[model samples]
Target: MGTEARRAGRRDFAGLWASYGLSNLGDGLVVIMLPLTALTLTSSPGLVAGVRWAQTMPYVLCTLAIGVLIDRVERSRLIRWAHLARVVALVLFALALSGEVAPLVALYTVAFLLGTAELVADLGTTSVLPMMVERNRLDGANSRLESTRSSLNEFVGPPLGGFLVAVGTVFATLSTAGLYLVAAGALLLLGRRYDPRPAGESAPAAKPRIRDELTEGLRYLRGHRLLRNLALMVCVMAAAWSGWSAVLVLYAVSPGPMGLSGTTYGILLTALALGGVLGSLVAGPVRRLLGTRNLLAVDVITGVIMLATPVFTAQPWPVGAATFLGGVGSGLWNVTVVTLRQQLIPDELLGRVSSASRLIGWGGMPLGAAVAGVLAQTVGPRPVFALGAVACAALLIPFLRVIREDTIRAAVASRDTRGE
Candidate 1:
């Protein structure tokens, strides 16, 4: 029965992954198209930046409630609804672009709704991970999902998106909307029908109140020294990494081998995409061989590469090298952290906990982007890149004590072993 259950889980996970990958590819296109659309409609950098602000600010403010929603409802239904919401938002975006109706406001509203929906989807997916597979396969499942995301969404998504945008905004956006609707349909038709645990196993006698659930997740996270320290480390690293990437256009525009026209910028984006593909492919083995802690240690080399890019006087190679290495580090880091969260959190509270988890980590993304803008304007583009590298290097140190070899080994073992 355990073996049969494990096989079923794998089958279900494969279907889920396919649906996610397709939708994620659409997301990749949307990221590029939306920014380009904004730039076309309004050439102001401030407005462009404001769009980013609208997208990120809500995650910090609204994720706790989203967490509650994920936990309190049937996750599969919530997942389907979130995708449906995205479908509507994307279609609205398509209409606004085609009709030029309420243009900027429509675009901003769409970005806001999509952002909110993404948080819900993210929370649901992370929370449901443990329920989707035998605990023992968590690392492998995470690695596969992360790799696909990096390879398809990061590597392939942008270039495809850029090409579609060049073809025309209306076509690109409408195509993306089509993808979202397809994903929604897939979720409805193909998702798992089995309950997380056996039937008649009774719900917990007293369902924790929403406030209590929220507090419990927070308190548990706080008391778990490993999770607490690792979360903090990730937040700092992500802040710096996000800030640097936010200003990538500025770096490319500066004099260097990396510098190029808009077309060249697309090429560089593709390069980063390819590098992410390579990273995702290798991240699992790297984690297994080095352990998560050692992987983090080795990742510091990439951080140094990123920092040193700014100090060099030469062109493209320096910047390109930094970007590639950073992408690799980020890919590995994502797989490790996401797997850790799924393993650590209990099944019922998974959604809320995962949502609360992101509230701290992803909450700072916009601030990081905003800071990059200010730093670029005030100091210089090179200084901003240098700062990001420094921040990545510093953030890893605190996490070392928590993500030791034993911790990683235990995490992997627990997730991989099927319980009878």
Candidate 2:
């Protein structure tokens, strides 16, 4: 398509992008603020880890149900509602924090509810994307979204969150709530055409049983070889990332480890986001240069860097460098995997399949976080990080052996021939 046509095509996408960026900014702030707030409530590592677990637990519990809902309703409307729900959750959280500390139960409750909204919003927004852009442009579209997310949520959001926390916890919480409201407003600007009903289904039909719909999604994922394999890989990757991330605040800020202050910790986290930005910029060219098969293997590089983070160095600069490199690999992997899924899955089944896949892939995260917390208490944060890295690296062996470029290409070609 020409530049003008592409730009025109992106008109709806611009709204989606802006909404996601705004929401991600709030997410970015919460990433640091939430855990820090949890720490103030209690010093226990397991309880602190529970905060991360709460944020991810909904993926396992609610994703399948959400998948069914997304396919049946207007996805844009669902997204708007999710963001508005998030706004309420954050506002309540801010209110709960009127004192110097919040109750642990309250923190977990808000975290879980916010995560529930996030899961629905993510599923709806992702499913809506292929409808808005050409199939061939999936890579570019995803790259743009990831880049914006990284820049706003990761890069700008973290440090800003840290600063806000330093200034006042209530201020940070309220600011995050305001951002979610803005995100909801931006999503409302999307055109009516954004939500396309599932194929072979009319608007006025009797509601299908949720269990049957959930089973259909599960069966579709179970039957697809490529998707099944990819989901397994995602599961391992999420586990590894979450395991290390669960205790990362303690490792980074506590006097016994890296011994960094809040401001420095935020700056350090920004290194990872900055690397993600670079990775987004390079993903297209790297895909072209490396071919799909090799491109998929980039996670091995990420795994290595992750392993190096705790085992190889305790110094801040080296840790930051490793994080940056890992972020790059993560960026490439996201673009490749998401584009591949978009190409291969039928639009009618996209929401279901995406949710099912994530149910397996992202489901590992909460378990990993909980486990990492326990392990950190028993062993130490460093060993937990090391173990997580090892698991990540080992998981790659099956992926490298099973997934070939020819098979992936053939699958996409076959889907295209069928007009999926």
Candidate 3:
């Protein structure tokens, strides 16, 4: 297709936004319900974390390949297919739950498929966004998207997911399935030809090998010092968060430390989302007043607050408050870093480079989850939180040394000079 043809009849952002919202709403249900379902099947910390790891490990193993795929094809078709696959997987699992046949294996099977589909769909969304909006407006656009993620997935979804699961786990699972189907339908209405190639880039008559494409992305990201440091910092943070999150349900549920009911546990997740909502609301102003480096710094402090509070107290409210702050940290991190990446990376390479960067950032989460299960099983969940806090704190030294006001400015400046 010609460049003019690609630019004509472009994908609608409003339609895309609506689909994104509905998709994440489904994810919110899955995020809470899956772990809760595993708890019903088995109480072993290792097993529970193992299930969680199953869902997220695709980001580690499959992200790099998905990134290359995004750069090569039209993203709308990719996302539509991903959503449909999720619907099928979710419906099967819901049926298994309703029939009382959902073993641990069933949960793992559904989780792995869901994780893979989610990676493709979510990356497609991020990769196409630069085509829809200008660079100067990326921060605002990303903040809105981040807030949608935080709200539906964390705030509205968790409490609702909890309530639905409390009423009937099968129903909750079915509802999530329904949402994915509807989300897929929304994308279908937008049509299938949302080619994401940047202006002036022609399609290759024959596609390059995935391995070659992936190497190009990795080489670009590796050569960029500022992004390299930022990605590394996120890797550390994600690993620590993974360790604490692996066995969190066991830490808070009945006969556990906090003694909260399943429904109330969802409410606790809501508290964390509450912070994210507030943080998203303020991130624009904070970024304007404080700038990017300082905005990024907030996450480390919030990380300590979140991971340490559980160690010092067995109270649910304290953990809730800590998560609220952590949510703020998350909001700040997403707005600053995503915007930075969008501005800096060229449109053609955005999918591959961003995915490669995420490979670096989230690659350790599965490992952390595996280790966390063992630690929680052996020493108890409380010690896992303490260790997570220590690990989160340890990032400060490298973070301070690498990411600074000058480095942030220099990165953007270099991009402008190159006219990327």
Candidate 4:
């Protein structure tokens, strides 16, 4: 197709987003289901954390390589192959369950492979967005994508997984595997076209040096004052959030002073999910009105609201309420930062740069969760949350100094003028 023709229709972009939205919902279900299945079989917190490692390890280890792959290959073809691999992994899980294999090892292996595919698929999917929309429309388009991901994956995925777990562990994994197959089918239906790359316009040269590519992506992020600060702030916050996630299931199921039971825990999950949905829906408008700086200022307030979760340390209702408000803040933070990143970063470096940025921002999460798990084992869950909250709050002080109006505008304008 001609360049003009490729840019003409919104139909393909709409379909692409729709398919991704559906796929992510399934992805969320898979995320929740794996942990629950492990809990059912092994009943070990570390094992559960280990499952998370299985999922995240690929992102940590393979991200730079995936970025290279995304830039080198056709994004749509890459997505298609990635989804196909996901189907195979899901099928492998089904076979393991059918054959009555040990759920832990089988699921762990599946999670590892699934994470590898997800790394590529996610890079391809997100990197292609800048190409899909007109330059002026990028913010709205990115906002829509973030909203879809937050609402479905973060909000809807957990509760659905828990509900399925309540039904039965094996049944839940099987059901989630089925969802993956459905997502695969959706990807097949979605058209296999993508935005053109600047590098691909000319004859492909020798692939850039890996170290050069990696450092270049980092340099770009560091060059932007806001990006550098935001990335650091998120890394710290991720440590806290990962702690909260590690103990959340345990907290809900505890019989002590502030614990909730099975179905009641599901209710809490549902509330958290609803809060995320509401937060995501409001993100774009909030960013527009507040602009980036004020939006982050609001994020700081929400962080305090999140710290209130400890106030509910003795009751489920208060915990649920705190979680609701925290969800809103987190939702807004994610949408704002993501939109800013898309607006600031160049499309040519979208994959590598995003992967590198994520390395600093998200790379610590699995480690955080692991650390929280060990600490929780010795120190108790409540202390972990309290300490994490205080630490996260302390970390934000530097961020306030880093994120200024000028920095935000410069970051936004960099992409704006470039038509990214």
Candidate 5:
């Protein structure tokens, strides 16, 4: 409300954003190096891919419990703890690599620890923003955060991580650990006022048992028609994207249709990140110009084009262009949907609600990938893309009908009316 408060808020938000970027950079390094490290020690494809399996498994297993913890604990501390956990995990892994007995199974445990920490950090970051900044700036703030994530985590970190591994695994792992430690320190520097728990929690009655609170959060998301629909939209979109992504290497690499070299395949993936960067930069202005409804529809349309492109053409460039567009749509969707949920969800319910939504959304990815693998094996990679395109296209009309702009405006108005 006062000038000093504004300055303090800005200072705290800066800390959060800086920590977020550094943490993402650390995560990106681990994501790449973990898999590549597994490959060095194991020749079995399943065991090699099991590294990714270990990392991602926590989203399915730990999200709700982590969500409850975020709502219960001070957010910054939770985030800082998560970062510290990664630091320990990475450092231990690094030390293990120096020994002759760095077992592949042990790597899976480290991956799990890193993933669980990531889940906490990500949910904490999302739920903490509304407390730190003015509501008017949420869209812009989210856009900037998304851009930073795409730029550092997806585009820059993987290649850099690869280079680090080539230098030495111990060096790369230790360096990633350093990034997480610095990220933890960033949050520790923020003032105490920025670290308060959810509002309206002073009253004893407002605090429920953990199980009850988790259930209430789930019910809140399920009961709200708009939020429920939005979550489903995200779930379906994630499935479609994952479906194509599962088989993309088959469609793109040498001896596949596109005939891309290993280096070119990486570059093609970077094109998607490039689009995410541009999309995040433009999201605020585009939301103002086209409005939410049209922008969301664009997300679905891009999904179709992205999946269908490989089916229609054997050229890497065209598929690269399509994936880039898909990334743009993703950037736009993320800023819009996340900002919407933040504004509309009660602050106390924000953590649980967001985690529930993500659970529904990300729950589809593994399934999509699994199904795509089977389908690709049976009918070939091209047919898998076609099936994914069809699934994505099916969402268009329903999304438009249910997600009218006025419904969202009414939801925001209701939240304000309730003084939530």
Candidate 6:
């Protein structure tokens, strides 16, 4: 029976995995296209920065509500709906771009709407994973998913998006919309029975109060020492990453800075994706070899590279190398952190807790982007990058002090024992 169950689980997981890959590729294409589209509309760094900020803003404002929704509704259905929403947004955006000039306001509005849908899809997909596989195999499953995301979204999609945008923005965006439609279609295969109600919850005994449900998720995170601290550390790291990334495209491609052409910039971006691919592949073995503590410690290498990039080199090759190394660290860090969160959180509370945690962790992204934009305009891109690296380095102190390797291992072991 156990063997049969595992086989069934693998089959289900494969469907979910494919859906994720298709959606992520579309997401990757948009990631490149959106900013470039904004640049074409306006040359103002702050205005261009708004494009990134608008996309991330939904996480801060809507994730808590979405988290509550995920807990109550069918997750697969929610994901499908979210993908459909994105398709609508993308189609509208492509229409807006069909003219000689795409309006900045339209770009911002579309970006925000797309981001709102993404928040739901991302949360649902992640929370749905444990249901598809046995708990023990979560790390491997997450690593595989992360690797796929990096490869398709980061590696293939960016270059393709750049090429498409170079040829024509409207065509690229319409193609991305088509991809989202495909992703939505893929989710239909998960079937109606995929999301069962949480354990101990009675059927439709009046709609649960939103405030109460929201509080439960927050209170759970507050009470759990590891989760609470981890969320905070993640917030800091996210801010640093966002700050650097907000200004990165302009810094790399503009004639004043690195001066690389669109295709070359896309190639440089691929170097980061390639490093992520390598990191995801090695994350498991490296974690086992180095132990959890050292594996996490290695993440600081990314901050170090960010710091060095501005001071040591302005040339594309050297900067690309730095981004590659940072991507490697990011890949390993994501697999480790995500797997740990999955192992620790209760299955029922997973959706709410994941959203709550992300609210804290990812909430800083918009703020960072806004700040970086202002700073870039004021102090220039190099200084903004330098400041971001310093912030990243400072975050390590709290990260190390709060997260103990033995505690994490013990928690996982306890969960396993309880499951048995």
lDDT of 6 at 285: 95
Steric collisions counted per model: 11, 0, 0, 0, 0, 0
Query: Which of the two, 1 or 4, has more TM-score?
Result: 4
**2 versus 4: better TM-score goes to:** 2
| Cand. 4 Cα-lDDT | 0.70
Identify the runs in model 5 with alpha carbons over 4 angstroms from their true place: 41-50, 96-103, 193-207, 246-264, 373-384
Which segments of model 4 are wrong by more than 4 Å? 1-9, 189-192, 254-263, 415-420
In TM-score terms, candidate 3 sits at 0.95
- Report the lDDT tens digits of candidate 2 across residue range 1-420: 567756756888999999999999988998898888887778888888889999999989999999998887788888989999988887787777885344678789888998899889888877888988898788899999888878887899989998999998889989999999999999767765554565555666587687888988889889889889989888888887888788888888866489988778888889879878888878899989998778778866676676557766779988998888887887788777888888888777788999999999999999899888898888878887888788877876787888888888888888889985
Rank order (by lDDT, best first) = 3, 2, 6, 5, 4, 1
Clashing pairs in 2: none
CA lDDT, every prediction?
A: 0.70, 0.84, 0.85, 0.70, 0.80, 0.83
Candidates 2 and 3, the one with greater TM-score: 2
Better of 1 and 3 by TM-score: 3
Deviation from native of the Cα of residue 170 in model 5, angstroms? 3.8
Candidate 1: list runs displaced more than 4 Å: 189-191, 194-207, 253-263, 307-314, 377-380, 400-403, 406-420
Pairs that collide in candidate 4 are: none
lDDT of 1 by residue, 1-420 (tens): 378777766776766777677777877776666766776787454565556667776677888888877767777677778888988888777888788798899888887887888778767766666777766677777777777777766667777887888888889888887877777676665446534334466677887787886776677677666667676765666667656655565556324335565445555565565656666667778877877787776666676676567557436666666667867876677777787778777676677666766777777777776777677666655776777777776665665656677876675466457423
Give per-residue CA lDDT, model 3, range 17-87, as digits (tens).
78899999999988789888888889788898887789879978899899998888888889888999999
Lowest-lDDT window of 10 residues in candidate 6?
Answer: 191-200
How many residue pairs of model 3 clash at the backbone? Answer: 0
Clashing pairs in 5: none
